[model samples]
Target: MNRPPLDRCTDGLPLPPGDDLDSVGPFVIRCVYALPRDGTDRRLGEDGTISRSLSAMQAWFAAQTGARLRFADEPVRTVRLPETDARIADRGSYVRDRIERLSRRQGFHEPRTLYAVWYDGSSTISCGGGAWPPELRGRVAALYLQGAYDDVVCAEDRFSPDGVAPEINEFKMLHEILHTMGFVPPGAPHHTRAGHVGDNHNDLMYAGDPPWNPSVIDPYHQDYFRTGRTDIPDLARSSFLDPLPAGAEPPPVW
Candidate 1:
């Protein structure tokens, strides 16, 4: 569905440096609305949903890490997938492998940029996928939004006022992006079998059967954000974070 002109709360928010450059800092998280050949383009980028939602995400990110995520710029990026919607759906469960197609683009494949992709395509679930930090083969976090466009992209319509979807849509994207950023490292105290937390179902990175009622990030601080443990990676130190904290160490070149 096409959005009406947006009177979104995109103004007056605490936005990071934006020049619309593909890459500028040591690390960046670029937002992209990727569409397949047969998919209808919704122009979520131009309409301010992506820009506004990501701003909300940064607000939430700061609450957790005291630093903001370094966004490439406003008016989120857009790309056309090499395959069709139907072809992408055929491999729905392996969504990451399919969405990784973006990494093939020179612009998207910059080693220091992690792409938070809103792929307008089909998948088995309201699908979102991220790479484990150790699995640094690709730097992409994708959400299959073909069916949940209204529920997810028209986030303001579904939940909250002012078109910000920090609770659900944008939160899901942040969860996936954190995963790609090497959060909830395997050695964390609550690190579930692998990439997520199992201590609390309400935890942002929980990977269990409980309701995904995410209200906080690494609530215990014993896992990813700022556990203060030098053994495992801490998200507070990720170079992708803007205004990097003092002496922040960049993650491996993914």
Candidate 2:
């Protein structure tokens, strides 16, 4: 009855409220703002873009998982300095330091803070873009923006109070949030009988194409939560088997 050598995380993911070991409660998201290394001169529209992005994320999570994901009501806290190398392996440390500083400022001892950064830079930092899950020490979910705040929540002429006006899309933000919540990597143990992962092509974890809406958390993901499986794979540096030859069958489920 041996198990893998990976560490077993006791944190309640996919659902919060860790008191009952199965209790589902709201997870706090302490939104923190940061600029790129050279973009300090720019003023961020925290109230407009950052606020909408977080709201949209909350809506998506609630619709998909029935779990309430909460955050600071207003955009009051923000990083004084730009994050150093937010797209690299050290991104977690950079984010963690900011969160700690924020916690100290608030004078709260133990608020579950997921450092949500409204980055004013290009997504090239992390190749395309993705969230740095909490499993990675110091890391949390983040939103990457290539342009100014207006690009995130602007209209044909001015700022729009409607909702998240993402320049790229909302899927990226949703994808990363799921990652932080212990969603399985794109492979077996998470796929369907047709070898499809993420419920289907419409799933948030799908490898490509298809927009974010209409996606959901399939039963496979539920199994992960219901069965108390907490070994969330670090997709950033996870080891894998060699690729199969052309026309060959896929590798067996790990």
Candidate 3:
């Protein structure tokens, strides 16, 4: 392929483990944190707002996995794949292509990772969300958050007498990230309501309401950080991905 060198094309992270193919190139994990252009009201409670919730979620992820996190403040237009001469045309396709290239390059022989994306537009309706590319049936090692879902409600609002709490935001962040990480596992029955339900939930995956239970943080989430099971399939076995491997020092956390 008449493309840029894979090293030049990548964002300088070590090639994730399973990616041994030069044509597929390096693995990249990008985040797009979309906030309302109108500027969210500063008074909303912590849990009522998406940004606040995302921060807490990111913090939890960072503390658990030691992966450096970055935020994107712009609209998600497209994500160009590494080593390909052409860029992915749309947001959904872009996400799919990236996963494909990463999986093949990283050697995700079984396509274990599952990619899922969610976008929040105006109104209380959680109408605009979609799954990752069908091609990425298994190798979806990571998830991305696309936009804001709703306004943050302040204590003054008649609906919420108390301000939104940080824990609530963390729970919301964890729920969505888990979807992206393929933590729900494949072929599980869907829920008909919202909120965390032990292994199941009437939650966002099933279009349920917010304020998910904090107890949702458990082995499913823990395995990703502690065991590297949550990492891109190719990279899962790499020293970079695993923290406690023999003679391997842990990556520095931010």
TM-score of every model?
0.81, 0.51, 0.35
Pick by TM-score: 1 or 2, better one: 1
Question: For residues 191-234, could you state the per-residue lDDT of candidate 3 as single tens digits?
Answer: 12221223323232333334333433333432222344433221
Per-residue error for 184 in candidate 2, Å, reads 2.1
Candidate 3 residue spans exceeding 4 A from truth: 1-26, 33-55, 62-120, 127-165, 187-211, 220-254
| Candidate 1: regions farther than 4 A off | 1-24, 147-165
Error of 3 at 30 (Å): 2.8
> What range of 10 consecutive residues in model 2 has the weakest lDDT sum?
1-10
> What stretches of model 2 exceed 4 Å from their correct place?
1-27, 40-47, 80-111, 123-135, 147-161, 164-168, 185-188, 191-199, 208-214, 219-254
Clashing pairs in 1: none
lDDT of each: 0.67, 0.39, 0.30
In the range 8-96, model 1's lDDT, one tens digit per residue, is 11123222222224455567778888888788898987787677777788777777667888888656888888778877766645566
Report residue 94 deviation for candidate 1 (angstroms): 2.2
**Model 2, position 212: C-alpha lDDT score:** 30
- Relative to the unseen true structure, what is the C-alpha lDDT of residue 205 in candidate 3, on a scale of 0 to 100? 31
Candidate 3 TM-score, true structure as reference: 0.35
